[model samples]
Every structure is written in structure tokens, then in C-alpha cells.
Target: MACMEEQRAPGHRWPYGPPWRSAPGGAEPGRSGLPWRSTLLLTLFVLVGSRFSAHGQPHRVPLDGSAHALLLLACVPLLWRYRHPVAVPFVTATAALVYLAAGYPYGPVYLAVAVGCLSAVVAGHRRAAWASVGLLWAGHALVALWLYRWLPPAGDKGADLTQEIVIATWVLAVLAVAELARVRREQWARERADRAQAARRRADEERLRIARELHDVLAHSISVINVQAGMGLALLDSDPEQARTALTTIKAASKEALGEVRQVLDTLRAPGAAPRAPAPGLDRLPELVEQAAAAGLTVAVDGEPPRLPPGTDLAAFRIVQEALTNVVRHSGSRHARVHFADGDGMLRLRIDDDGPATGAEAGGSGNGLAGMRERAVALGGTIEAGPRSDGGFRVLAVLPLHTREDE
Candidate 1:
């Protein structure tokens, strides 16, 4: 989770994070090698340790014949431990109790019960695991106490016995540490999955935003060109020269808008693909203004600019594009002015037009203004747009050109 926070922190790479350690090709949790190996190694360890103990101890009866057969039978369920851990441990524990009751050597059975206790701890509820371990240990202790009554005469072997108990405790502690590692690995896997899901959601939202912008930009532009083309056709017989000029301008504007729309659509079609060209930036403002002019919106630019970061450049370009689009659609304006300047550690833009009164009927209830404001604020800037008290609409933005290094 902490890794997720670091990867998504502000000012880091947007939307996508760096690559993660993926699950191996064609490997899945249940079908992977891990569970099989865990079962196989544990089974071998139990069987070998039992045989070795019987051989080492002269007094202990060798677990052969029917008793040995029963012990082997009890362990068949051990292979199911990873998938049905609680069931395996419960069955094994019952078998261990019966084996000890049948008066066989308890050492091998006791060790099996200990391994089962560890599995139960990991796979069962915390309270149930604690209860199971305590009950098994107490049963083993009682069996040991009962055997003490018939054992050979006592010997002075206190230090040796203490050392053996210490070693056994250390072995159990090591096994518990191994279980802890397994749990932490599972936690990391879950965190990685969650991070991937969040990144996908962010990508979907960004795609939606791009789609919305394309719809507004292209739909509105094409609709205007259609209307202008029809008007030119109707006027051709009466006003041949004016109609011819309008038709030419419409062709040029429609072609340019189509190219821009195609570029945006290509991005939407395959986000992972490399772009054919960089997105429009402030350097392309002249081309954008020329297209708007061809659409019959007279536009003038007045001012100089400073070198800017790419992000700022894109934001500036989009702002102008959206503002000019609004003028053509709602302003009924014959002329528009765009002013840009950089000073006092800030870049300022002002767009205004002398046009007719565009009321609520014209669909100019600040949707474009709000979109422009959102764009500016995302890059640490501000915008204000409304009817300019001077009988025109004004869209103005003040953006920071300098900030702290951390920004």
C-alpha cells in the first residue's frame, strides 16, 4: 500500500506507474509449482524423520507392521493441506491421538501433529488455531507423563535433556518464521493487484475526457461548415463571387478540422501506440487561428511570449481553441481579439469579441468557460469569463510561469 502511494503521489508520472513484478507467464495460483513442492517436501521430511528416529532409539519399537501401515495411511491426506488445510490438520490430529492410544512409539506421531498444528495456524481462524495447538500439546504432555511411570531407572542426564528441548523449541520457531514470510508475500501480491486496478480506472477516465473534447470540437465545427456550405450554394446564382469565396473557405476549414479530429481519434483508438505527431502546442496557435478565420470568425493576435514548458504550451493552445470555437458558435461576432503577454512572473491571456447578445437561447451558459477554468487550474492557474460589461464576452486567464522547484 505504501508503494502504491509513492507511485501515485502528486507530480509523479500521471495515470500509469512503473512496471510491477508480474505473475510468471502461464502461472496461476492453484496450478503453480509452489503448492506442489510444499506438499512433497513436507511429506518426505515427516516420513524420513520418523524412520530415522526409530533406528536411532534402541528402546523405541520400530514403526512397522500394522502400526507403520496406519501411520502411512494417516499421511495420505497431507497432500491436500494447501487447499483444505483445516481438514487435513483435523484428520491428522485424530489419527495421531489414536496411534498414541494404541501403545505405539509416540515420537513420529507427535512430530506429525506438530506439523499439522503449524498448518492449522496458517489456514484456520486465529482462535481455533490457538485452541487446537494448546489441546494437542496438552495431550502429548499427558502421554509423556504416563510413560514416565514405566521408564527405566533415572540417570543424571538433566543437561542433555535441557539442550534437546532448547533445540526443539528453536526448530518450531524457525518454522513459524517461514510461515510469516509466506503471509507477507501474499500481502504484496494483493497490493500489486489493487494498484493495477486503480491505474486502469484512471486510464478509462482520461479516455472519456478526451472523447468528450473531440465530440465538442469536431461535431460543432462540422455542423457550422455544413450550414455555411448550404448558404453558399443557395447564393451562387445571385452572388457568384461571394458564394465562390465562401465555398472555398468552407472546404479549407472542413479539411483542417477533419485532420485534427482524426489525430485525436487515433489517440483514443490505441492509447498504448506512439503518437504520429506531438499534440497541438502554443507554437501551433497560428494554424488554429487560421482555421477559425477560414470558418468566418475574424481573429487577431496581439503580443509576445516567453519559452514555456510543454504542459503549459498545450494548456494555452487548448484554451484558445475552445474560446474561438465558442465565439463562432454563440457570439454571432464578426471579429475577435486574442491578447497574450508574459510579465511579473506570470503569463496572461485575454480573449474578447464584439458580437450580438448571446442569451440563454444560444446555449452559452458557461460550459466552455467552466472547461477552460478547469484546464487552467489543473496547471496552477486561474480563469474568469462572463459578459464583459462592455457588451461583449471576455475570457481571461492568469497562469504562473514561475514557481518553487518542488512544483
Candidate 2:
């Protein structure tokens, strides 16, 4: 804008041109590989229109073989414009300049030069486009104001001020339009890239969500199943009735795990569909205790957990489930306790079990504690798990009472 105002200031050489802005490299090439259709149309328009232009301006030299050749020269390079953005505009501008210096009537030849410049600017070659158009305009100004007397049809006078001003205005308009187009194209490219990145982020989040769900459900249930299987195996020969009881627990655990797995898979099969059953929450604490007892870990619950939003409820349940699963799989203690508290719109749940350091050989597949932390943090909460100085491991989670959706 300041450059444009400078040109309009009195006594500034408006007949020359405006300063050009530096720009980045052009947009990527077109996939169509060739612009044969548009290039051929431009050539045809320039060739057909020159005759009418000559008739309209008799003082200008009429079109002839050399003139026709020069016009084609200007139009032909446009065939490779996208493939060679910088070179194409300069070639077209130089050809047009030579044609005009020979005093060929102004016609669609300028249209060819305009196309070349536009192509260059849109392809991310703004400086080259500006320079090329400026070269053509400067060459025209030189020939019209001075060289007109020495060349072309006899007795052509110096171009008037009005003619030079009109030519300058046209040059300015072309550059302005090209720069505007380049800016717009860059904006669209940025929008497209942003959308793609957002899509990938959403995909990653969904995959992580499914993974956490599967881990919580299977880990807790499988820990129960493993214990029951061991009990059933040992008791199958002695205490047949107790063996039957352990087998029953194993069957129940396996069935629940499969149902939850199917639910997770159903979501993948039909996205945007509601779950076939509501998600588990802290309300399922009694069931978790039953499962833990069946797994040979006695769990004592401390306080009543408040009802929570569906999302918070699910996260809370998964955190507790994972914590208890870690206790069963990683701690040697046969007893664990869950302590829950609510205040100031926050819920804190801590699971602890007495422990001697269980050897690293204790088997578990995924990072159960890490998974717990993820669930807590997703709901604007936090999780901390470490062995206490009292010779016990502890998993603690603090979740917000009001989630963003609830807020």
C-alpha cells in the first residue's frame, strides 16, 4: 500500500513502475502435467485478434510475417508455464517487448504476457513475474517516448502523457492482481494442510481411546481369570466343590471380558454410534470388589463415590480397574484397599496394597499405571503411582467433578 501511494505522489516517476515485493517459490506443479488446452486458446486469441487491432490503429505498423512470429513466440512459452514458472513469464515479456518495439499494433499480445505473469505469480514466483512485466513496460516506455522517432512507421511522435499513464496503470493493475492471487492461493494451501493435520490428530486420538478401553477391560478381567484358573487347577483333584466355584468365576470373568471387547469392537465397526451398553463407572465398584475377591485379593472400599458425568464416570472406573489389576498382577500382597474422597468438586481415589518388591519377572503386557494416568489426565485430572515408605505400592488418581462438557 505504501509503495502504491509513493507512485501516486506528485513528481514520482509514475510512468516507470512500482517497487515489487519478494515472495517465496511457486506452488507445486499441476498434476495434469501439461496446460495444452489453455495455452492453445491463448495463442489462437492473440493470432485472431491482431488483425482487428491493426485495423483499429492505422498509425501502428500492420501485422506481417515477422509480427506473427513474434506474437507466437510470446504465446508459445506459456505451454510450459507451470513447469517453468520463472522462465515462462520472462520469455513472454521479452517477446512482447520486441514485438512492440517493432511497432506492431497493441492487441492480445499483451494478453499473452498477462497470462505468463499470472501463471508465474500463482506458481509462487512473484518477483520473477513482477520483473518480467516491469521489463515489458519499461521497454514500451523507452520505445514510445524516444525510439518512436527513429523506428517503426514513418513520423510516429513521442507518446503523450495520457498514453504513458494508462500504460503504467495497466502494469500496476496486473502486478496487483497477480500478488492478490498468490496470497489467496497460499491461504488455501494452508487451510488444506491444517485440515489434514487435524484429521490425523483425530485418528490418533480415537486409536488411543480404543486401546485404553481394551486394556482396562481385559487386564482386570484376565487377572481374575488367571487366578481362578490356577485355583480350579489345583483344586480339581482335592475339594471338587471349591474347584467348581473357581471354574464358575473363571467363566463369568471370561464372558464379561468378551462382552466388553465386543462393545469396543462395535464402535470401530460403526463409528458415531452409541455404545450398546453404557460404559462402566465407579458405580461398578462392588462388581470390581467381587472380581478381585475371586482373584484371591480381598479389597476393602472406604467411602461412597459420588455420581459423575458419563465421561468422568468411565474414566474413574477405568482408573480404579487398572490400579487394582496392577495390584493383582504386580504386588505379592493378598489384600488391597480403595479409598475415595470428594471435596471442592474433585474426586480422589487411591488404591494401596502392602508389598515386598515383586520381582520384575511379574508378568503384565501393557503399561497399566501409564494407562491409569492417561485416563485421569484426559478428564483434567492426575495419577501418581509409586511404592510407599511403608513397604506398599500405591496408585492415586484425582479427577475433576465437573468436566468441560458439564461446564
Candidate 3:
């Protein structure tokens, strides 16, 4: 699983892993073999220190074959420190101890130990890093005490104490820097995850809104066309003039449905395209009523429409359109009344039909009603729809004007 995750693009992950780990035969997955940077740094440290010692640096360790081999054991494994953080630090520190115990001059072996400590911490092995630091400090102190007791003094005790303090400070500084890097890496990973999740949620909401728009457009127009076609057939022989009117109504309804559908498809195809026209709002309510009346349902408006925010206006228009369409398609109603009221920052709408109850009116699929409620709720409103005790169906919606404006 770690290998598969590493195979993904670097931008999709935390930026702390070895970059070339995916190269052919580079290293085992999740293991950084010998990175070129680590190799370069270690080689430079050994070569320069060896050259300096050869130039008669009396206190430096001699570059004899055995000492060189020990140095290699301490430093070379650091190339794979990220792969085995704990083991690498222990190996390097152990080799350094052995070299010091052999009475060889203390040279650059401690550089390898410092590198191991840093790698372990940055690799998120906090326990391993602390253990390695503690072991290195203990080993150095014990070795110094042994040398002081057993060997002839080459310098004052004050100088030895200063050297030990300097070395301890350097190790602690390296650990501090590595820990800071790990914290930053974790923060970046969390922020990236949050951004990806937000993007998914936005995509889901856009899809649902588009689905509701398509349903409302298709359902209302299809219901009108169905009613007009029936009326045209009923009057084909008895009244040719009336039949021609019904056919005209069908043609108009089909044309309107096509235009609305085309607009929706065009917007989907070119999301950044300029607006072609304004969306239908409550200003078009009279036209909606006329369409229903033409379809053989008597629809009456009881009050003047109130001013609304664009979002609320569009939602209100759709709710009324859907409710009237339902009456025509399923209520068997001959007369319906649409009442509107504005009071205290709220716009109230009610559609009631005077048709006899049918099975559809009592227990229906209710997709239209569900869509209406969703629209209302999305705009901080509520909708109540059910069969009325007096005989027909009623849909009541209360939308907060101030809430829409605030949003």
C-alpha cells in the first residue's frame, strides 16, 4: 500500500519523501537506498577531514586502513537512514563508540551520528530519535570519564568540558530543526485534504441543482402538451376552430419547452459563457396562469405579487408552476386559486384546487412536491403540501425575504 501511494504524483502527497525512489532498481518501495545528496555530503566530510589530518593535525585521527573502514561503517549506512531510522542511528552511534574505544583519534565519525539523528526525527520516528540522542550522550560521557581516569592528561579539564557542551548543543539543535520540519509537513497534508473535500461537496451541489431544473422544465411542459393534445382530439370533429386552437397551444408549449431545455444545455456545455437571457421569475406568473387556463384548468390569481430577491423569485415561480402542473396532470381539477401575501419580510404562497379526490391526490409518487420543498428549504423557507379535507389538494410555502437577501 505504501508503494502504491508513492507511485502517485508528488503534488498529491506530503513533500518529505525521497524523490527518486521510483527509479528502476533505485531502492525497495518505502526505502530510500543511497540518495546522491547523502552520498555527496558524507564523501566530502571524510575526504576533507582525512586530508586535514594528513597535513599534521596532531589531535586528529590518523587515516589508517582500519580507522578508514570504521569511518565507512559509521557513515555509509546513513544513505538509507529514512528507510530504517532506528537501526541506522544505532549502527552509526555503535560504530563511533567502537572507534573511540579503540583509542583512535576522534575525527568526523560524529558527523554520521548527527545525520542519523536528524533523519530519524524528520521521518516521524520521535521515539527512535530521542533514544538515539540519549544513547549518543551517554556513550560520549562514559568514554570521556574513562579517558580521564586511564589516560595521561593532554589538556585541562575545562577544555574537555567545553567540547562536550558544544557537541551536545549541536545535536540538540539538529533534533529541533528536524522536528519543526515534520510539524510543517503534517500541517500541509491536512490543508490539502480539506481543500479536496470542499471541491467534492461543491460539485455534488451543482449536480443536484441542475437535476432539479431539468425536472421542473420537462414536467410542466410535458403536462401541458399532454392536456392540449387530448383537447385537440376531443374537438377534432365537433368544432374544427376549437381544435385548431388546441393544436396551436400544443405547438407553443413544445416550442417553449425546447427553448428552456436548450438554454440549460448551452449553459452546461459552456459554463463560462455570457448570459443569454434572464431566468423566468414571478413577473411571468400571468403567462403561467394563461398556459394552465389554455390547458383546460381555471387558474385565478388573488393578490399582487411581491418584490423578491432573484433567487427567491425564481424559486417561487417554479413552485407555483409545478403545483399548477400537478393539478392539471393528477387532480382532475377544473378550478384552482393561487393566493400570495407579503407580511413582515415573508412571502407566502398558497395553491388550492377544487377537484374531487383521486388515488394520485391521496397517495402519489410526490417527486414534484419533494422538489418544491427542496427549493423552499434551500432558500430558508418551508413548504406544506397534502390533500385538503374539503376535497382537493393544497400546497403552501412561506419564504423569508430577509433570509434570502442576507444569504
Candidate 4:
């Protein structure tokens, strides 16, 4: 029962568990957990080592049946190296030490110890890797001393020096390769995380932009519709012709609103589809003034708008539209003036109404003003809006044309 419980413990499985698994989700059945390819390669190394030992290679220690079993014990644990990176190196190193102490032949069985060291480093077990290296060097020195005292010399001093150099070079190379792989994996993960964050930020900005569009389109249209409907109802019994005209204005405004709304929805639903109409810009200001006049607000234009970048033009139009809508719905203004000017590489817009400030203007949540400010600021511009001291409300926006051109 204790054995079963140990196996079931998180990250403490004897053969495989939490830290052994690749990342959060489980790895493919044969690819990660089982590692059949590595098993096959280890098997090949064992076979080759056995054959070389049997043929009396100078470097190979002769192996009896018990030494052969010890060799298998050292190498077989490598199958679980990835699952227990730190543990695997310690187990293989201990097995190799036992084999060496028992005077078994040093053959390809040491390959398992090298692989475990590499695995520990790649698995981010830095302390374990250093410990394994220290243990390996200490064991090697002790074994050499034991051989010098108890066994006949197989080679000269020069031959022993060359072998030591080669073994040290091999160990350093394994560590270098594992460190490089870990660095590369970490870099890739960081880059993937950055890309995901950028995508989410762009998505949030797009949602805000779409919301602003919908609010401007719907709010302005519904305000006009409400005014016209009210006028029609007030005049229904006395001025039938004027009432019919008001109803006609309402119908025209509603139809235009529906079309604009559908266009925005189409662009949202099918981004690759052809646009139903060009976005509103400075050139559409005349039509906007007409719409306001028809809705019973007398609007006057001061100067002609210069040609502008698409983004700036769209932003300018929305700013004017939102400001005019406020004058009509909240300002209680009969007359409003829109002034446009281009000078000093900046396009300037000023809208003022000769009406008393309403409660909505002073104490409202100001989503419209906030949205307009966001749009202007996004284009590297500024806007100021407040109730005028003389008698009314005013909004002024300054946009940099040169900045748009440079972009």
C-alpha cells in the first residue's frame, strides 16, 4: 500500500510523474513519456560494448556475469531519465561506481552516466548537475588510485594523460550542448508569450474603436428621430402639412441610420468583404449640417476643410458629429457654428452653440467626451470641451497634419 501511495503522489512517482511529464498537458504516448528511440539507442550501445569487451579491448575491463548485471543496472535506469532528471544521474552514477569498485571493465556503460548528466542540465536541475559532476570526478579519482595500487599498469603515463584529457573534454561538451538547448528553449517561450500579449492588446483596441463607432451612429440617429417624432405629434392636429414634413424627415433619418449601422456591422462580421460605403469625413460635413437643420437645430459652417489623412478625417468627422448631437440633445441650442481652419501644419476644429448649459453637460458620465478625447489622442492630437462663460458650450480639437503625413 505504501508503494502504491508513493507512485500516486504528485511529482513523486518512482518511474514517472509530475516533473517527468513535459509541461502542463501530458505528452504524446510514445514520443515523450516512453522514449522508445532512446531505449533503442541505449540497447545498441550495450550490445556494442559487450562485443568489444568480449574481444579483449585494451581499454575495456573484463566483465564476469555479475559485472555484466551491474552494467545493465547502470544503463537500464536511463529509460526514465526525462521523468526523473536529477534522480537518474544519481542512480546511474551510483551504479557505475559500484561496477568500478567491483573491478568490472569500463566500457560504453559510462555513456548512461554522461546522458543523465546532460538530461539533468536540460531539465533545469543546475544544482543536481553540479553535484553529479563532483560525484563523477571524485569516483573517477578514487577508482584510478585503487587501480594504481592493486592492478598492473596497462599503459604508460602519456597514455593515461591523453585518456584523462579526452574524458574531461567529452564531459564538458555534454554540458555545453545541454546549456545551449535550455537557453534556446527559454528564448522561444518568451517570444511566444510576447506575441500572445500583443495580439490581445490589439483585440482590446479594436473592440473600443468598434464601440465608439456604434455609439456615435446610434445616438445621433435616435436623437434626431426622437425630435422629429415629437414635432410631428405636436403639430398633428393643427399643421398637417408641417407634421407630414416632420414624419418625412424622421423616415429619411431612420433609413440613413439603418444603412450606416448595417455597414459597420458588415465590416465587423466579414472583415475581408468590400466596404459598403466610404467612412464619413470632412467632406460629409455639409450633409451633417443639413441633417441637423432638418432636426430643427440651425447649424452654420465657417471655413472649408482641407484634405486630410483617412484616420484624421474620420476622427474629425466623429468629433463634429458627437459635438453637434450633444448640442441638439443636451444643450437646448437653436443655433450652432462649426469653424474649420488649417495652419502651422495643424488642422483646427471649433464648434460652439448659443444655448444655456444643460444638466447633462455638467453632471453626465461624459462617455462621449471621453471617447472623443481617446480618438483625438490616439491620433496624437488634443481636444478641449466645456461650457462657455458667455452663454453656451464649445469644443475645440487640434490635429497635426504633418504627423499623419509622416506616419
Estimate every model's Cα lDDT from 0 to 1. 0.63, 0.83, 0.76, 0.76
lDDT of 1 by residue, 1-407 (tens): 12222254567442232222113232224364434555566566666777777676655445767666657655766655555656666677667655654455536565555555565555433344445445544454555555434443232112244544654575457457546744654566566677787767666656655754675566446645764776699889999987887788788767867877887777667655766867667787787677676667788999965777766676777778877877877777879999998888789999899867554243433456666777788678998887877788888988777644326
Q: Over the stretch 1-407, how does candidate 4's per-residue lDDT look in tens digits?
A: 11111223355333222233244222323364566677678867875786577577555456667776777787787787777788888888888877766555557777778777777776788678767766875676666644545543344122265566676677778778778766755565565566566657766787788788888887788878888898999999999999999999889889988998898888677755767799889888888888899888989999988888888999999999999988888877789999999999889999999888565533233588888999999999999998889879999999877554656
lDDT ranking, best first: 2, 3, 4, 1
User: What lDDT score goes with residue 330 in model 4?
Assistant: 86
What stretches of model 2 exceed 4 Å from their correct place? 1-31
Candidate 1 Cα deviation (angstroms), residue 279: 2.2
* lDDT at residue 202 of model 4 (Cα atoms): 66
User: Candidate 1 — which residues are off by over 4 angstroms?
Assistant: 1-41, 97-124, 146-175, 216-220, 223-227, 268-273, 354-356, 360-371, 400-407
Clash totals for all candidate models: 0, 3, 0, 1
Per-residue alpha-carbon lDDT of candidate 2 for residues 170-219, written as tens digits (9 for 90 to 100)? 99998889888778767756755665666677777778888888988888
lDDT of 3 by residue, 143-260 (tens): 6755544532344132377777887898788788778866765566566566566556666666777778888888898888888888899999999999999999989999998988
* TM-score leader: 2
Worst 10 residues of 3 by lDDT: 1-10
